[model samples]
Target chain A: MSRVIQIAGLRYRYPDGTQALDGIDFHLNSGESVALFGANGSGKTTFVLHLNGLLRGEGSIEICGMRLADGTLEQIRSKVGVVFQDSDEQLFMPTVLEDVAFGPLNLGLSPDDALTRARTVLKRVGMAHAFERAPYHLSAGEKKRVAIAGVLAMDPEILVLDEPTTFLDPPTRRDLLSLLRSLPQAKVVVTHDANLARALTSRAVFFDQGRITGQGDVIEIIQRFHWEYS
Target chain B: MHHLVIDRWSRGSSSLHQRDPRAKLAALLVFLVVLSTTRPGAQWAFVAYAVLLILTANLARLPILGLASRAALVLPFSATFALLTWWSGDSLRALALAEKSFLSGTAALLLVGTTPLTGWTAALESWRVPRMLILVIQFVYRYLFVIAEQVQRMRWAALCRGPKQRGFRLAAGLVGVLFARSWQRADGIYHAMLARGFRGRFVPAPPAPFRSSDALFLSTCLAGCLAIRMLL
Candidate 1:
């Protein structure tokens, strides 16, 4: 498959003189699923923000053969389906159906088309009955599913997840991992769930001090890190 | 903690419920402005406003009785001001305050009764409302239930520990706990948005195709109301 993302010499600094990312390089191919592992404050979240240009970074990053630009951020956003870790912040709509339909409608789909797509994605996520339910009434698992549906309505080529599993009940976490594993888009999961990483990903990129310190097959990378520590 | 079985009309069905939310919003706003602009003792206008409110309530299938209780909720605060007018021997001013307060409540009740929460949001989206603003409203509406749920759970937990004879006294820690839990819940949602490539802008509300009937109804009602206020 063709390369879906290319990041070269990426460096990012916050306004407070804190460098969030330091000279990093990474690439992801279409259909690949990669785990981006790191400790807290390790720039994992910052790097994911750069994917959709929610946060600006220095140097070069290209998505789907198009060089990302300020003017084209919205277009790039539509193409990269991201499921934020916070389902509450992601689902900022009064009802489930409207929340899911948001992305497609923004992309200029007709109301009927957008609602149909929302229904399809919600059903796919096993949430067909929650069309009118408030996001607040939903359990954590349900909220996460609805958030995923919101992104799925966009049908992005690359789904970039920021800590896809967090604070979820074990069953919900497993279900979410399975759901992420099932999507066809290339994935970059920023997660601390070792089991989740092992079960869902084929490749691993060890992120440290704002850069990729190691990249290889999942087992090799996990084995290397485990052996070094043990 | 929130009760599940709140009054239905405050959250129910009628032809008013079926109308476009933007129309309902505009109608309510115009009606409120007209009612407020009237002289304090424009007795004729007050009767006209009350008549219009009742007619709309009938159309919206709302309970006329509950309108008073709902009106009462807004009355106490404004009553103090009305009391001042009464104390100053301005019975006319007092009457005006009373009329304005009741009419304002009537206008709001009609608006919310006619418009479901979701439809109001969809209307805002179709109007090219800023994504962030729409998202704020969406999040507030969705999580209002979540906050209610959290409070309910905490109250249940408190009751489990406290004796029945103790009465319904809220614990100091309960507020802190509820806020913390909701905060954490909010954190999870924010992270989910980031994962899915949410860049602060919310998904826009879908706009339904405008039917001729909708246009006709909106124009006639609005025009008639305007003529009554301005010309008559």
Candidate 2:
């Protein structure tokens, strides 16, 4: 299987000298979905931030076989789309359509083409009705969908979603899961919800103290780690 | 939440709303210039300006009372200067100070009410307004709702825990927390932008072509205001 993402000896230290990520090794195969399970501050976010070169540290990272570096950061960014946990943070444009088009436009698509792609992706995510709606007026679920559509509009090869279901109700989560499942890109989901990991990801990797402690089938990892609360 | 009312107002289909933002912005500049330069004690000019704004507000289909009340928000600030002017014995200038500020505020609100935030900001960009300033304005406008909601939720939580009279201390604490939250939120927003291939600048959607209709609208507004400024 072709590897979409590969990292070795990944390490990151905050300005305050705390090691956020330490000597990590990971890989994601093409068309595979993996769940990143860890407690808060277990370097899950910091690691994902590295995938797009948003937070660089001591690491050798490659996306689709291209080594990540300053010169290739922009190209890597377009290849690994990240959906932030907070939809408010993700959807900053005045209108939903503009917000969705933001990524495509930034990727250098012509304005007409970007907008057309944005509308198409918005429809794909069932947000076409809110094309002109101010993003602030959307409900949490709707905002998350728009956020995903914004990333999808870039036509990225991989999606890194950090708590995509944070504020969603059960129905919304189900809908989001289905929408996510329909997408063809490889995915790395940082989640605390074991059921979500099981439902959406084929494999799971557990993190503790900035190190991967285990990697295996989703149900086995969840069961071994007791990831769910009664 | 109250600002949402204006946001909704901007989405309307009135003739004024349909005018290009550049035209509306140009007209607004002219109105401000004429209003600001009017001679002291030119009560008739001020009257004409107020009437013009009211008529424009009517054309935009915005509720007159709502627009007036929201515009009155500027009064407390201007009223201070107006009061000092009155105390120093320039009652005419004082009254004009108050009237000018109110009318100015109303005119500005008309522009925002008629044009969506993106529309007006994009117009500002076309006029060569600094990209950083436009970016800041867009972010502030977009996050105002998010921050306001945070404030509301915090207020509710504070109320749930204690007496409302002790809100001063609660408010102080709220401000600190809100600042920290806003900082974190801004960081997240920047990261999200970066992850999506943003390289410092927002790629503005292609602006609609500026048409003769827009120019005609600006001309009519300018002539009408100029006529009122001189002829009134």
TM-score of each: 0.69, 0.91
The candidate that wins on lDDT is: 2
Query: Candidate 1: where are CA atoms >4 Å away?
Result: A56-62, A67-75, A93-95, A106-112, A132-137, A217-230, B1-11, B22-67, B90-96, B117-232
**To one decimal, what is the Cα RMSD in angstroms of model 2 from the true structure?**
2.6
In model 1, what lDDT does residue A76 have? 82
| Per-model DockQ against the true two-chain complex | 0.28, 0.76
Best by DockQ: 2
Q: Tell me the tens digit of each residue's lDDT in model 1 across A22-127.
A: 9889999999999888778888988988888878889898999888897777778887888877677788766788788877877767888989999999999999
Question: Per-residue CA lDDT of candidate 2, range A88-191, in tens?
Answer: 88888889998998898888999999999999999999998999999888999999999999999989999999988887899988999999999999999999
Model 2 DockQ (Cα-based): 0.76
Mark the regions of model 2 whose C-alpha exceeds 4 Å error after superposition: B40-45, B77-94, B155-174
